[model samples]
Target chain A: MSALLLHALGIVLVTAAMTFVTRSAPFVLFGKKRGTPPIVLFLGTYLPPAILAMLVVYGLKDVRLLAYPYGLPELIGVATVVGLHVWKRNYLLSIFVGTAAYMVAVQWVFQGTL
Target chain B: MMKTVRAAFLTTLPVMTGYLAVGVAFGLLLQKSGYGVAWAALSSVLVYAGSMQFVLVGLLADGSGFVAVAMVTLFVNLRHFFYGLSFIDTFRAMGRRRPYMIFALTDETYSILCTAKPPEDVDGKAYFFWIALLDQSYWVAGSIAGSLAGSLIPFDMTGLGFAMTALFLVLLVEQWEAFRTHEPVFVGLASALGAVLVFGRGNLLLPALVTIVVVLLLMKKRLTREAYAPPTPPAPADGPEAGGAP
Candidate 1:
């Protein structure tokens, strides 16, 4: 779609043109609407979270649990994420801890050297 | 204006890992598919989709016809139509930058705009415009890197695609905490599940979005007038770029 339509030069120019037309110009179509469309407002709020959950599930799709020597890395990471999210209610902390656990698992647990 | 930029930065910072993972994946995939830096920059600049761009690479590989390509691209990117619809009030007043703002509509940019609250001294229009700019900068940078480095980087980079999902996870948790309403969450889940069941995994987002719209319409009576819309004001900031000489 966009890839084929835009080459290096074509991409830059078309993109810039679209932006120029959409944002740089004055109020046009969606602007000054009598009211926010009912459906738009509803979708705006919930779409981020639902799509996000789907993404999480998608990432974990086909992940092999028992194939790992101890299943320690993923187990620790997911548990830590759920735990930290529930415990501290901090998004950043959950990601950090889970990611760190995965790193450690790959580096040490898999090797059984650390 | 500065406050808006600062806020956008703060908000976008939380999603960097997601952006980094997805951006890098797009770049790698683009380069691998014979797209150059120009292509990367162009789409990142124009299309401005976080994950949809990645999917576009496959479409390009298939050699779909121009009309098909455009139609499919538009359909796939139709979620963006909602993005524009929601922010109409804010971007409508951008004066000069309004057009670019509309064109540069990315999910990250929209998220920034959706959550943004103009500070006392800042102009909402300018703030809205700048948020879109900063978000585009990140995408453009990723595109440039992907296209430029396409020739150099080797080995499979498929793992980077996980970034899209990772980011969605981060946002999910963030919004869950910020808002009081939960109906939207239920609707989205039900829709996504419906999409997965109906379209299978290959084309889930569209069905999911459709499901969302249908449910909201069906539940319109119960769900109306509950969500918070940001305040709107019409005035240029007290001269652009505060804190300069008289």
Candidate 2:
């Protein structure tokens, strides 16, 4: 209870500091300066996508070749989400359907063991 | 307007799943380490970096001093500094909410915002804003859920972490399907493989991230820009009298 508040305090402060550093450094230091090295600009521009793609791949590195030996439920759910994502290009829809599908498939078929 | 909202919401879906899974694990880790939900919620609201939050939990658990945490986190989040560079142009147009919007910027949010070139008829800034807001909201919700549900659920939430990986693959498929551009995908894979090869399992994120950035930077000139580069206007319809009058 009270402990939660204290813990949150540290978390909040750190979060704010990190956010401020990243978000404000450019505006503060540059102060609306015009010249940005093209290499820096280029790296900055593409870095987000590159970072995200890396994050995703890193996130999934643990997904097994087979769940429950076959791991069909998790595997199938992931496949379905990918399918929906490509078909609709809708992130929310795909996630919602994927989560629901994953949840449902795991519960009903695997008896929630997954 | 609705379309933009729809896109924002859609773009945030994966974010939501990733947040929930990661955020909950964070909550569990913190709680077991004697921290509380408040820390989880506030950090989610503030820091909002998925991997860093996990790292922070471990650091705190290790009882490292503040100076160590600060330095490590600074580097851990150093890439975010680069994220803002590209966003400068996009953020400037945001007007009043600029500061707050920038504060909420994360890799995932920035990725969504960066690719959004508002239709000629729409405001790109607004689209970026909504996307950022929506993504942050999903994060906030997940963080809160994780914090509040710390011990309420009995299942092993680590398995839930799979959601993040699964969601990433989904986004990858989505991007590849829509863009048909292999450059970004190739760079991402190369970086991941690079990290796996070099880092050898000691926090592959930093290496992979560096590889992606370095690779992308190296290849910037070769790739074409966005699809919305507004076609050049026809040369005054040839004045209807040049060579052959209408």
Candidate 3:
């Protein structure tokens, strides 16, 4: 329709195309062949945990440790999650409580200071 | 089909909560940036990557060039390359659905699929598809709601984004419990932390991933022995190892 809409569409298409490339790289590379290498299989087995751990870090990458709050909200939130998960072993409860705790910490406990 | 959908829904309940919050946030931001409901829906349906969608709002608002948009998307989503490696065989077995499965492999979907097992009666492929489909639906629905109600909803959502971090932490704990040896988990944490320190948070992921792959390769002999070792016995038929093995 309009120039802005067209431009936005272009941005969306480009972003989607690049994203698909990354997501499908492994499938395209290893999918055509019948048998995959043992090393690739090994990496597949072990890489999930590593990647999950990295994702956790990536999620918190924006936390400014040297600032006023000094990453306290995230630290407490993580502690809450780990403690609740280890103790109760409930997935939904751990995430809900941990996230709520982090919210309260950020929204009120550390409010203006951060 | 209904049974599989029901099971998938139950399994994705946690993600339902997480995605709706973040998706709505994305929608509100996009709406605030002058895009409307149609744009929000389009982005969620086409792009589907949560973090990247959030970044896209800023890029769209500033009218960034397509080259800039592509570069930013690649850098933001490069981590996804490793995600499909774990699922290559699993998705390959899904027949024609293989392409969509790969396309929908967001962080949340990838994590849940890694651990969540279908019920005894439901088909595994159907279960996987429903999970992916339902997760995306929640996102799309939330985006539309936020775009429409952007002006009406005035509540502060400052900390709601923490749900993602919480979800990841919970999954990490599950992964830690599932695997007998914790070396991979430790390797991930140490590598990421090292990369953060050395490369800073903004540019750490690529280096972190590289270190992790190299380190894992070096320890393959020992790690593989322990992973497939008969001493600890295998983790149940539906365990993480099941997907990796041919």
Candidate 4:
């Protein structure tokens, strides 16, 4: 309707299209083959853990190590997560507690200090 | 089908919590940025990538050029290319659901799909599809709710987004336990940390992923051997038969 909405729609479309391209490129490249290569299979099996590890890092990439709070909240939060997960081995419990710890650390414990 | 959906729902519960928190945050931000429920819903349903949607709100607010938007989107989402590598054959087997399976492969969905195997009696394809669908539905529902509640809500949700980080960490630990060796995990952590140190946070993902692939390629022989190696026999006296058993 309006120019702004039109522009926003264009941005959304482009963003969606580019995102889809990235997600589907691997399939499109390897899909037509009769059998998957051993290398691809190797990557499929092993790459996930590495990717998950990378994602953990990616998630914490924004934490500032040099600043006042100095990434303490994230450290404590992650420690809680790892500790709870290791000790209890409960998925939901670990995530909920870890997240709550993080929220408290940022919201109250380190509030206005960042 | 109902069984598949129920199982998928249970499997995606963690994702549900994380997505709703982050999705509501996204919706709130978009609404605060002058776009309302309709825009929030559209983007959540169409784009569906969590972090990218958050970034999109800023781009929309600034009225950034399509070229710039596209470039930013590509850079932010390049890691997704590798995600599909893990699912190519599995998704191919899904037949008619293959395209949606690919399209809905968000980080959370990908992570859950990587580990959440269906029960023996349940249909694996249906399970996977429901997980993907249910995850997206949570995201969409959260977006709409946030947009609707943004104006009325006057509360602080500063770090609820950490649920996502916690989700990843939990999954990482699970993956660590599932694998026989932790080489891939270490490789990932080292490569990503190296990239962060060298490239800085915003630019680390591509380099980190590239380094990971290269390093894993080099370590292929050892890693594959470890991954596929049969369990060792307790006693050496039975070693010959053990070695030839498979």
Candidate 5:
């Protein structure tokens, strides 16, 4: 088999394994009989927002502040997303407008520079 | 079972809207990255993680080592570790369907299950199973459609990837409105900022998540109790407890 295909297979397996491990950890460690420990409950209830916030940062990790564009496209794009979401309370509108704004900024306004 | 499935489908309608947009973006990006529809559909079937799949594209394009990719996958989906905690009992009772239920516990599915209430006469496990199955089907279908469109269209979709970010932000705002305590959000933001300063952008996520988990663990006493505390009941209008006529 080709190396690229091998890599793809490896990726699929590794990712699937990782997902299984993560999802089943609480179950494996605590088992079915034991009540979910307080700590686990605490983390379960609170971790969603924390992880969501981290994902936002992760999503923006590639934008370079030191570069010529200075992350303006990202900032404006996020602002559009936040503004539209808060106002219209429509997820589709917010994501569509935000993504379009970012695409326009990067493809046109910030086209010349990296 | 059909009624349960219908209700589950109804509950998953909102996620369908979100998943279609993001899943299409994933497909388009994957096609642009030089992968074909088979790879797109395969990943959606096997990995089934929207955010991590985006990261996976970058990793695959770079031809990164297996070890590095595996580590990144673990770190990216670390949050799924906790998603299953609350559902342990619910899923354990699912008999033959237990494994698939566990496998399909994506963030969106978890959210729907957390709030889902099967009609009184319906089987709860069946309802949960249908929700998960329907949600996964929507994602898989969206991704396949996206890949087909990406291959057919010649349009440049620069900046469209922000849909995932926008999705996360919208979910964050909704969580913020629902929860009384904002400590976890602050912990996440601060930890991420600190990680960025220490580890740089490319390597920030793992450390930031580690730090947030640690901080939350340390402050578990205060956070767990208040974060999900049920609202206090109102006083009776004409009782001694109320400042009204007795």
Candidate 6:
């Protein structure tokens, strides 16, 4: 069921506000004069890799290993993305090829009787 | 301004593809859930976080209470708080455009702004603003197209979602190459795997992030010391700023 217009608006607005606040919080809290605390700077300098790694995992969180084709499709898909990116260093090529590979795997190769 | 815009467009060209595909998926899913194109457009225009927008599809479909939805959105977007810390000075320097920069600091944009600098002749504000604007436009255009075409599309989209994962992986690889220290990367991977085993898929992200934080804090002496050390070699003398005009 679709949410009521009012509820949808409220949810969307709240999400927007919360997101805006979080993104701007660092700047707002630190201000321009005092500068960012060293620990905060440390996190700022270093958190990107960790966050990106977490995002990579988060992206594939739903892939099921217990299923018939298992997570092979996912594994292969990731390998293609990683391999192609490592080889080419082209972001667009890697993502397009990796996605195309996954689409083929699930749609045709790993197609389970539904 | 034109030159800066062109360079920004070039810089954001990679994100353009990812946003379009993911945005289409979002629109299709939102339409499938009974919301109209207007709703899809509004959500894309407003919420704007790619992963959170995808999650919002479910939350919207479920007709969840505002409080619950708000909490989930906060949790999903908590990392953004970290993203801003790095850009605080740069964004503050942008004066009038600072607010939009903050609002548009999505994961991909943050990644781009972290490493890419404009050519010496290009205005940094113009470059940064155009990047953010162009990226958002791609999302809006893609989502609107998908919502409009959602009902007419006939093909299976079974594994198309992996584009997002692929995007993240590509970014991870780039970050890995950029960083000299492997501690954060390893900590993130290990923490995520631990979370997967302990919390399973549904509840993994927050715990994984917390674990990374805890471990990073415990090892702060090493990480911070190494991170801020003065450059051993000469800094890149040929950085984009020095590369002059396009």
For model 5, residues B39-77, the per-residue Cα lDDT tens digits are: 889999988887889998898788888888888888888
- Residue B78 of model 4 has an lDDT of 88
List model 6 lDDT by residue over A1-114, tens digit each: 434878877877888888887788888887466454666665666777887888788888877778777888888889999999999987778888998998888888887822
lDDT tens digits, residues A1-114, model 2? 466444546545764686568667875654365654555555554454456577666755654555553566667677877788778876667766776776666666666353
- Please give, for residues B143-246, the per-residue lDDT of candidate 2 as tens digits: 66666775686764434555665656655664454443567777887788678767765567767776776676666656535642211111112111111100
Which residue ranges in model 2 land beyond 4 Å of their true spot?
A: A1-15, A23-31, A66-75, A101-114, B1-11, B116-123, B154-163, B177-180, B224-246
- Candidate 6 ranges with C-alpha deviation above 4 Å: A1-4, B54-65, B117-121, B154-156, B225-246
Model 6 chain A: lowest-lDDT 10 consecutive positions: A31-40
Task: Supply the TM-score for candidate 3.
Answer: 0.90
Q: For residues B40-122, could you state the per-residue lDDT of candidate 1 as single tens digits?
A: 77677667766567766766666544555555555666666655645455454466786677777666565545445556676
Q: Which window of ten consecutive residues has the lowest lDDT sum in model 1 chain B?
A: B237-246
Every model's DockQ = 0.24, 0.36, 0.65, 0.59, 0.44, 0.52
lDDT tens digits, residue span A1-114, model 1 = 455454434433433344334332223543556654545554444455444445455455445555655456556666766667767865567676666666666565676422
Q: lDDT (CA) for every model shown?
A: 0.57, 0.62, 0.85, 0.84, 0.75, 0.78
What lDDT score goes with residue B153 in model 1? Answer: 62
Q: Where does model 4 exceed 4 Å of error?
A: B226-246
Top candidate by DockQ? 3
| Chain A TM-scores, candidates in order | 0.59, 0.62, 0.88, 0.87, 0.80, 0.84
Instruction: Give the alpha carbon lDDT tens digit for every residue of B1-246 in model 4.
Output: 788788889888889988988888889999999999999999988898998998999999999999999999999998899888777667777789989989999999988777775777787778888999999999999999999995565777788778888889998998888777888899999999999999988888889999999999998878757355532211112112211102
Question: Which residue ranges in model 1 land beyond 4 Å of their true spot?
Answer: A1-32, A37-114, B1-4, B59-63, B116-127, B150-166, B225-246
For candidate 6, list the clashing residue pairs, or say none.
none
Which candidate, 3 or 4, has the higher DockQ? 3
Q: What is residue B161's positional error in candidate 4, in angstroms? A: 1.0
